[model samples]
Target: MSTWNRTGPVVVEVDGSAEYLRIVDYASAEALRCGAELVLVAPYSAHASVSPMMPGYSPKAPAERADDALRAAVAHVRHRDGYATELAAVAGEGSRVRVLAHAARKARMLVVGRSRSRGPQRLMHAHTNLTLASRAGCPVVVVPASWKPCLMDRKVAVGIDGTALSAEALEFAFGTAAGREGDLTVVHAGLPAEHAWNDEDPDHSWISRADHLLSETLAPWTGRFPNVRVTRFLSSRQPAAALVHESSEVGLVVVGSHTGALPVDPVARRSVAAMTCPVAIVPHHVTATDHERISAAPRRPARRAGRSDVLTP
Candidate 1:
């Protein structure tokens, strides 16, 4: 069970890599905008069976080293941003996916950096991003290492499948667009007609049905976010390809991952890896009971502007 409460901090994984630093910058800016604390987590795992007969086989040394690295990385980022009070650091011992996934249970969102490799190389080592996106308690945002902050056309793109998962993604996309005062583009990809039909052809009923479905899916959200400029893109291509192409022009792409559909759908996996900008994977259903518990918990006071704190796990 995972809570989808907004009271939790935004968690970002930091490994002191160049890609991780870029992630830090993006995550920091996002945290400030959302008025949420930024948590940097560094996860490490030690090799098993270090024989005492060998020189200096201390079991606690690996954990201490990981903690030191995490502390340094956090301090560096905090100093660079001059946002000491808005940040916290945590050091955990385990595999990266396991540790970060655990942290995400109490986070508003989890942010991570993607590798520069593309095509086959990228696919070969995309398990980390896929796992986090599919299994995290909250939404997971994956940003490319080469992405930098700059002036650009601001728009949020969401893929709509007319499913409950897609509805949740629509809510997130609409809220994000409203918060940023950006444009919202809802894309629905439908299969092509088996035979060409003219405008007046009576056999074009399927096309009309697809159009109606798109409209019905977006009707409520358009009213909810009246201020957000909305654009509808109905494409004949596959959903993954259409969204991947749309990702090039938007600041963020929002996609839905069913609760148990991971490593099973090749299209979903490919879309996440192909996106040029940050990709946000929103789950269909988070635990309602967990949300209640989190909402009922006591709230902590805001930290003073100059204070800095580090948490260990």
Candidate 2:
């Protein structure tokens, strides 16, 4: 039997870095507010730092350090929040990323700090955040150090353009919303007005059909998630621009890596580069078995474009 709960459990992943703790604090507070349980993974390991002299030591040191540090972090969290959190050192691993992916099986959402804290003038590292979101199984929430968790409708957002790959994204998003007890927004963008009803054009029907398809695609999920509010919006701008624009108000945005027979939107792929929030590129084949949640996940295959982005308070 799988340890994974079909109901929903929000998982917050951390290295317990100062930056990550801030994120955990923010997310935990939100979870508490939403009446959701927080599962904290304080890996006893640390990623091996770059050192030619200690190449082999890099892999093992992080596990031990992460385990110890995570326990301390959990203790602090318990004292501050009035209850102890479920903490895991994440037993075995091929790598930190790989371990987390496996643990994600039982989680509705995976939370990770986008990057370490930086000076006021510093910017976030797109590569790190992208890798975490792209590879994670569940919808990955990239919490920033400066992020202020507020009680708003701006919960998780999933982008779907009527593709099977989108079904994967929606399934993950719906499960995450249920876990968080948060609202969800479905955003779709079509061509400019000229292409909206130009039935003569080869792809005109593609744009025209979005409204109905968007409604149908989400129909089954609505009844299953009455408490998790859903909103559908259509834009006449380019897919990437509109999606990125919608992300400005969302805590996270979920998009299909590639949907059905169509390749993932290049702009949406790149739109993540400039998105105001974290974007999880949900893959089509993510699944896990029993008890412990998988921590690291398979890396998102190389995308055609490589722009990524993040922000802070």
Task: Candidate 1: count the clashes.
Answer: 0
TM of each candidate vs. truth: 0.79, 0.66
Which residue ranges in model 2 land beyond 4 Å of their true spot? 1-11, 26-39, 42-64, 91-94, 116-136, 175-183, 199-207, 227-229, 258-268, 278-281, 286-313
Q: How many residue pairs clash in each candidate?
A: 0, 29
lDDT of 1 by residue, 194-284 (tens): 5324567745555566567778878888887899999888777667788889988998988776454423235566777788899887766
lDDT by residue for model 2 (1-313), tens = 1123333455666664666677677657646654666766653334466778876654446567666656766766777786644434344435656666666666656676654434321233443433444555455665556666565435888767664446667776776677667889887765457556665675546455776787788887786677888987777765667777887787777765532232334454455555667566554543432112223434456662322111100
Best by TM-score: 1
Global lDDT of each model?
0.71, 0.59
Give the Å shift of residue 86 in candidate 1: 2.0
For the record, the alpha-carbon RMSD of candidate 1 to the native fold, in angstroms, is 11.8
